[model samples]
Target: MGALPDGVYHIKLDDQQFLTIGEEGAVTVLPAQDVGQKFEVRRASGDNYAISKPSSIWPSPFVCYDGAPAAPYEGTRVRLRVSDFPPCEWKITAGSRPGTFTIVVAGDGQPLTIGIAPIPIFPPFLQLTSSSGKDLGWTFEEAK
Candidate 1:
Protein backbone atom coordinates (compact mmCIF):
# COMPACT_ATOMS: atom_id res chain seq x y z
CA MET A 1 0.00 0.00 0.00
CA GLY A 2 1.16 3.53 -0.81
CA ALA A 3 -0.51 6.91 -0.67
CA LEU A 4 -4.11 6.09 -1.49
CA PRO A 5 -5.83 9.30 -2.55
CA ASP A 6 -9.35 8.80 -1.24
CA GLY A 7 -10.86 6.65 -3.99
CA VAL A 8 -11.70 3.06 -4.70
CA TYR A 9 -8.68 0.96 -5.58
CA HIS A 10 -8.50 -2.58 -6.80
CA ILE A 11 -5.91 -3.90 -4.37
CA LYS A 12 -3.93 -7.07 -4.72
CA LEU A 13 -2.64 -8.70 -1.59
CA ASP A 14 0.13 -11.22 -1.20
CA ASP A 15 -1.67 -12.79 1.72
CA GLN A 16 -3.79 -11.05 4.37
CA GLN A 17 -2.31 -7.61 4.93
CA PHE A 18 -3.11 -4.80 7.32
CA LEU A 19 -2.91 -1.18 6.19
CA THR A 20 -1.69 1.56 8.45
CA ILE A 21 -0.93 5.23 8.01
CA GLY A 22 2.37 6.75 9.04
CA GLU A 23 2.89 10.06 10.79
CA GLU A 24 3.56 11.79 7.45
CA GLY A 25 0.39 10.43 5.83
CA ALA A 26 2.15 7.60 4.03
CA VAL A 27 0.54 4.20 3.92
CA THR A 28 2.44 1.41 5.61
CA VAL A 29 1.89 -2.29 5.81
CA LEU A 30 1.49 -3.95 9.19
CA PRO A 31 1.14 -7.73 8.99
CA ALA A 32 -0.78 -10.45 7.27
CA GLN A 33 -3.87 -11.65 9.09
CA ASP A 34 -7.29 -13.02 8.18
CA VAL A 35 -8.02 -14.72 4.92
CA GLY A 36 -11.21 -12.82 4.08
CA GLN A 37 -11.16 -9.51 5.85
CA LYS A 38 -12.67 -6.42 4.22
CA PHE A 39 -11.91 -2.73 4.52
CA GLU A 40 -13.16 0.63 3.38
CA VAL A 41 -11.45 3.72 2.02
CA ARG A 42 -13.14 6.93 2.97
CA ARG A 43 -12.84 10.67 3.37
CA ALA A 44 -13.30 12.69 6.57
CA SER A 45 -16.92 13.49 5.77
CA GLY A 46 -17.94 9.80 6.08
CA ASP A 47 -18.18 9.48 2.31
CA ASN A 48 -16.59 6.20 1.49
CA TYR A 49 -16.50 3.04 -0.54
CA ALA A 50 -16.36 -0.22 1.37
CA ILE A 51 -15.34 -3.76 0.59
CA SER A 52 -17.56 -6.19 2.46
CA LYS A 53 -19.61 -9.30 2.07
CA PRO A 54 -22.28 -8.82 -0.57
CA SER A 55 -25.61 -7.87 0.99
CA SER A 56 -27.54 -9.93 -1.51
CA ILE A 57 -26.85 -12.21 -4.42
CA TRP A 58 -28.78 -11.85 -7.65
CA PRO A 59 -28.34 -11.09 -11.32
CA SER A 60 -27.31 -7.63 -12.38
CA PRO A 61 -29.93 -4.91 -12.66
CA PHE A 62 -28.64 -4.03 -16.09
CA VAL A 63 -28.67 -7.57 -17.37
CA CYS A 64 -30.98 -8.09 -20.34
CA TYR A 65 -30.66 -11.74 -21.36
CA ASP A 66 -30.76 -14.58 -18.86
CA GLY A 67 -31.62 -18.21 -19.46
CA ALA A 68 -32.70 -20.63 -16.86
CA PRO A 69 -33.50 -23.78 -15.03
CA ALA A 70 -31.30 -21.65 -12.76
CA ALA A 71 -28.67 -24.32 -13.16
CA PRO A 72 -25.42 -24.04 -15.03
CA TYR A 73 -25.65 -24.52 -18.75
CA GLU A 74 -23.45 -24.04 -21.75
CA GLY A 75 -24.04 -21.15 -24.15
CA THR A 76 -25.76 -19.04 -21.54
CA ARG A 77 -25.53 -15.32 -22.19
CA VAL A 78 -26.27 -12.14 -20.26
CA ARG A 79 -26.60 -8.75 -21.91
CA LEU A 80 -26.23 -5.56 -19.90
CA ARG A 81 -27.26 -2.06 -20.97
CA VAL A 82 -25.69 0.95 -19.29
CA SER A 83 -27.45 3.97 -20.73
CA ASP A 84 -26.86 6.45 -17.96
CA PHE A 85 -23.72 8.00 -16.54
CA PRO A 86 -21.72 5.08 -17.78
CA PRO A 87 -22.99 4.49 -21.27
CA CYS A 88 -21.94 1.10 -22.57
CA GLU A 89 -23.07 -2.44 -23.20
CA TRP A 90 -21.81 -5.73 -21.76
CA LYS A 91 -22.37 -9.29 -22.81
CA ILE A 92 -21.38 -12.14 -20.49
CA THR A 93 -21.43 -15.74 -21.61
CA ALA A 94 -20.55 -19.10 -20.18
CA GLY A 95 -18.38 -20.97 -22.65
CA SER A 96 -19.62 -24.50 -21.87
CA ARG A 97 -22.05 -25.15 -19.05
CA PRO A 98 -22.75 -22.82 -16.16
CA GLY A 99 -21.21 -22.97 -12.72
CA THR A 100 -20.31 -19.81 -10.87
CA PHE A 101 -19.37 -16.64 -12.74
CA THR A 102 -17.69 -13.36 -11.99
CA ILE A 103 -17.70 -10.39 -14.33
CA VAL A 104 -15.81 -7.15 -13.86
CA VAL A 105 -16.77 -4.03 -15.71
CA ALA A 106 -14.11 -1.39 -16.15
CA GLY A 107 -14.21 1.41 -18.69
CA ASP A 108 -14.36 5.19 -18.97
CA GLY A 109 -12.56 5.37 -15.59
CA GLN A 110 -15.25 3.47 -13.70
CA PRO A 111 -15.17 -0.05 -12.37
CA LEU A 112 -17.80 -2.51 -11.16
CA THR A 113 -17.80 -6.15 -10.19
CA ILE A 114 -20.72 -8.44 -10.93
CA GLY A 115 -21.05 -11.83 -9.34
CA ILE A 116 -23.35 -14.63 -10.49
CA ALA A 117 -23.89 -17.54 -8.17
CA PRO A 118 -24.36 -21.16 -9.04
CA ILE A 119 -27.86 -21.99 -10.33
CA PRO A 120 -30.11 -23.91 -7.94
CA ILE A 121 -31.78 -26.13 -10.58
CA PHE A 122 -34.98 -26.61 -8.52
CA PRO A 123 -36.91 -24.89 -11.32
CA PRO A 124 -35.94 -24.89 -14.99
CA PHE A 125 -35.83 -22.61 -18.02
CA LEU A 126 -35.22 -19.21 -16.51
CA GLN A 127 -35.75 -16.28 -18.89
CA LEU A 128 -35.55 -12.53 -18.85
CA THR A 129 -38.89 -10.89 -19.52
CA SER A 130 -38.38 -7.11 -19.19
CA SER A 131 -36.21 -4.34 -17.76
CA SER A 132 -36.35 -0.72 -16.65
CA GLY A 133 -33.76 1.73 -15.35
CA LYS A 134 -32.96 -0.20 -12.21
CA ASP A 135 -35.34 -3.09 -12.55
CA LEU A 136 -35.20 -6.45 -14.32
CA GLY A 137 -37.57 -9.33 -15.02
CA TRP A 138 -36.93 -13.06 -14.72
CA THR A 139 -39.12 -16.15 -14.99
CA PHE A 140 -38.48 -19.79 -14.20
CA GLU A 141 -39.62 -23.10 -15.65
CA GLU A 142 -40.45 -26.26 -13.76
CA ALA A 143 -38.35 -29.31 -14.37
CA LYS A 144 -39.78 -31.99 -16.64
Candidate 2:
Protein backbone atom coordinates (compact mmCIF):
# COMPACT_ATOMS: atom_id res chain seq x y z
CA MET A 1 0.00 0.00 0.00
CA GLY A 2 1.16 3.57 -0.64
CA ALA A 3 -0.85 5.61 1.88
CA LEU A 4 -3.77 4.56 3.95
CA PRO A 5 -7.13 6.07 3.04
CA ASP A 6 -8.39 8.28 5.88
CA GLY A 7 -10.52 6.21 8.32
CA VAL A 8 -10.65 4.42 11.63
CA TYR A 9 -8.44 1.35 11.98
CA HIS A 10 -7.00 -1.25 14.27
CA ILE A 11 -3.25 -0.80 13.93
CA LYS A 12 -1.63 -4.18 14.39
CA LEU A 13 1.99 -4.64 15.25
CA ASP A 14 1.91 -8.25 14.17
CA ASP A 15 -0.42 -11.24 14.15
CA GLN A 16 -1.26 -10.88 17.85
CA GLN A 17 -0.28 -7.48 19.15
CA PHE A 18 -1.76 -4.07 18.42
CA LEU A 19 -1.04 -0.44 19.20
CA THR A 20 -3.03 0.61 22.28
CA ILE A 21 -3.20 3.43 24.74
CA GLY A 22 -1.84 2.02 27.97
CA GLU A 23 -2.01 3.24 31.56
CA GLU A 24 -1.32 6.98 31.97
CA GLY A 25 -1.91 7.39 28.23
CA ALA A 26 1.32 5.81 27.07
CA VAL A 27 1.13 3.96 23.76
CA THR A 28 2.00 0.28 24.03
CA VAL A 29 1.73 -2.95 22.07
CA LEU A 30 -0.85 -5.40 23.39
CA PRO A 31 -3.56 -7.83 22.34
CA ALA A 32 -6.57 -6.12 20.75
CA GLN A 33 -9.42 -5.02 22.97
CA ASP A 34 -12.75 -3.20 22.82
CA VAL A 35 -11.13 0.00 24.04
CA GLY A 36 -8.13 1.97 22.89
CA GLN A 37 -7.30 -0.16 19.87
CA LYS A 38 -9.21 1.82 17.31
CA PHE A 39 -7.45 4.92 15.95
CA GLU A 40 -8.63 7.62 13.61
CA VAL A 41 -6.29 7.85 10.64
CA ARG A 42 -6.76 11.31 9.20
CA ARG A 43 -4.83 12.80 6.32
CA ALA A 44 -2.78 15.73 7.59
CA SER A 45 -2.00 17.17 4.20
CA GLY A 46 0.18 15.49 1.58
CA ASP A 47 1.30 11.96 2.53
CA ASN A 48 1.09 12.53 6.29
CA TYR A 49 -1.64 11.13 8.54
CA ALA A 50 -2.53 11.94 12.12
CA ILE A 51 -3.33 9.04 14.47
CA SER A 52 -5.66 9.70 17.39
CA LYS A 53 -8.17 8.11 19.73
CA PRO A 54 -11.24 7.33 17.66
CA SER A 55 -13.91 8.08 20.28
CA SER A 56 -12.47 10.43 22.81
CA ILE A 57 -14.94 13.01 24.10
CA TRP A 58 -12.14 15.48 24.68
CA PRO A 59 -9.92 16.74 21.91
CA SER A 60 -8.08 13.77 20.49
CA PRO A 61 -4.42 13.54 21.40
CA PHE A 62 -2.24 12.84 18.43
CA VAL A 63 0.32 10.05 18.60
CA CYS A 64 3.69 11.75 18.32
CA TYR A 65 7.26 11.99 19.50
CA ASP A 66 7.68 12.69 23.20
CA GLY A 67 9.31 16.06 22.54
CA ALA A 68 9.18 18.78 19.91
CA PRO A 69 9.26 17.48 16.35
CA ALA A 70 12.88 17.15 15.37
CA ALA A 71 15.09 14.46 13.88
CA PRO A 72 13.91 11.30 15.64
CA TYR A 73 17.29 9.91 16.50
CA GLU A 74 17.60 6.33 17.79
CA GLY A 75 15.63 5.55 20.98
CA THR A 76 13.29 8.57 20.86
CA ARG A 77 10.15 7.62 22.79
CA VAL A 78 6.70 7.82 21.20
CA ARG A 79 3.65 9.15 23.03
CA LEU A 80 0.35 11.00 22.67
CA ARG A 81 0.37 14.77 22.75
CA VAL A 82 -2.62 17.08 23.04
CA SER A 83 -1.15 19.65 20.68
CA ASP A 84 -1.48 19.32 16.92
CA PHE A 85 2.21 19.90 16.42
CA PRO A 86 3.53 19.36 12.92
CA PRO A 87 5.70 16.56 14.27
CA CYS A 88 2.50 14.83 15.35
CA GLU A 89 2.01 13.88 11.72
CA TRP A 90 3.22 10.61 10.19
CA LYS A 91 3.84 9.18 6.76
CA ILE A 92 2.27 5.78 6.18
CA THR A 93 4.05 3.86 3.49
CA ALA A 94 4.29 0.31 2.21
CA GLY A 95 6.42 -1.97 4.32
CA SER A 96 8.65 -4.92 3.49
CA ARG A 97 5.70 -7.21 4.18
CA PRO A 98 2.56 -7.26 2.09
CA GLY A 99 -0.57 -5.77 3.73
CA THR A 100 1.59 -3.89 6.19
CA PHE A 101 2.93 -0.34 6.34
CA THR A 102 5.62 1.56 8.20
CA ILE A 103 4.79 4.69 10.23
CA VAL A 104 7.47 7.32 9.78
CA VAL A 105 7.62 10.63 11.59
CA ALA A 106 6.61 13.35 9.17
CA GLY A 107 9.14 15.86 10.45
CA ASP A 108 12.04 13.59 11.36
CA GLY A 109 11.56 10.91 8.68
CA GLN A 110 12.36 8.02 11.02
CA PRO A 111 10.21 4.90 11.28
CA LEU A 112 8.44 4.16 14.55
CA THR A 113 10.00 1.12 16.20
CA ILE A 114 9.12 -0.98 19.23
CA GLY A 115 11.21 -0.70 22.37
CA ILE A 116 11.25 -3.02 25.37
CA ALA A 117 10.35 -1.36 28.65
CA PRO A 118 13.03 -1.20 31.29
CA ILE A 119 10.62 -2.61 33.87
CA PRO A 120 9.05 -5.99 33.23
CA ILE A 121 5.67 -4.85 34.50
CA PHE A 122 5.38 -2.37 31.67
CA PRO A 123 4.65 -3.64 28.17
CA PRO A 124 6.62 -2.86 25.03
CA PHE A 125 6.37 0.78 23.92
CA LEU A 126 6.85 2.61 20.61
CA GLN A 127 9.89 4.71 19.78
CA LEU A 128 11.65 6.26 16.82
CA THR A 129 14.60 4.18 15.69
CA SER A 130 16.94 3.85 12.77
CA SER A 131 15.21 2.58 9.67
CA SER A 132 17.99 0.12 8.94
CA GLY A 133 17.51 -3.42 10.28
CA LYS A 134 14.30 -2.55 12.11
CA ASP A 135 11.08 -4.54 11.83
CA LEU A 136 8.70 -1.57 11.71
CA GLY A 137 5.83 -3.01 9.73
CA TRP A 138 2.29 -2.26 10.90
CA THR A 139 -0.97 -3.64 9.51
CA PHE A 140 -3.95 -1.30 9.45
CA GLU A 141 -7.30 -3.06 9.38
CA GLU A 142 -10.35 -0.87 8.83
CA ALA A 143 -12.35 -0.73 12.04
CA LYS A 144 -15.92 -1.94 11.96
Question: What's every prediction's RMSD, in angstroms?
Answer: 19.5, 2.5
Model 1 has an lDDT value of 0.25
Which residue pairs in candidate 2 have backbone atoms (N, alpha carbon, C) closer than 3 angstroms, thus clashing?
none
Q: Candidate 2: misplaced stretches above 4 Å?
A: 56-58, 84-87, 108-121
What tens-digit string does per-residue lDDT give for candidate 2 at 1-144? 455888998988766788898877788888878888888899997877888887555656778777656556667777777753334777788887888787777764445544434446558777776666556478988989
Q: Between which residue pairs do clashes occur in model 1?
A: 68-126, 69-124, 69-125, 69-126, 73-97, 73-98, 74-97, 124-141
Which ten contiguous residues of candidate 2 have the minimum total lDDT? Answer: 108-117
With candidate 1 superimposed using the best TM-score fit, by how many Å does residue 61's alpha carbon deviate from the native?
32
Q: Note the clash tally of each candidate.
A: 8, 0
Q: Evaluate residue 15 in candidate 2 and report its C-alpha lDDT on the 0 to 100 scale.
A: 61
Taking all chains together, the TM-score of candidate 1 against the true structure is 0.19
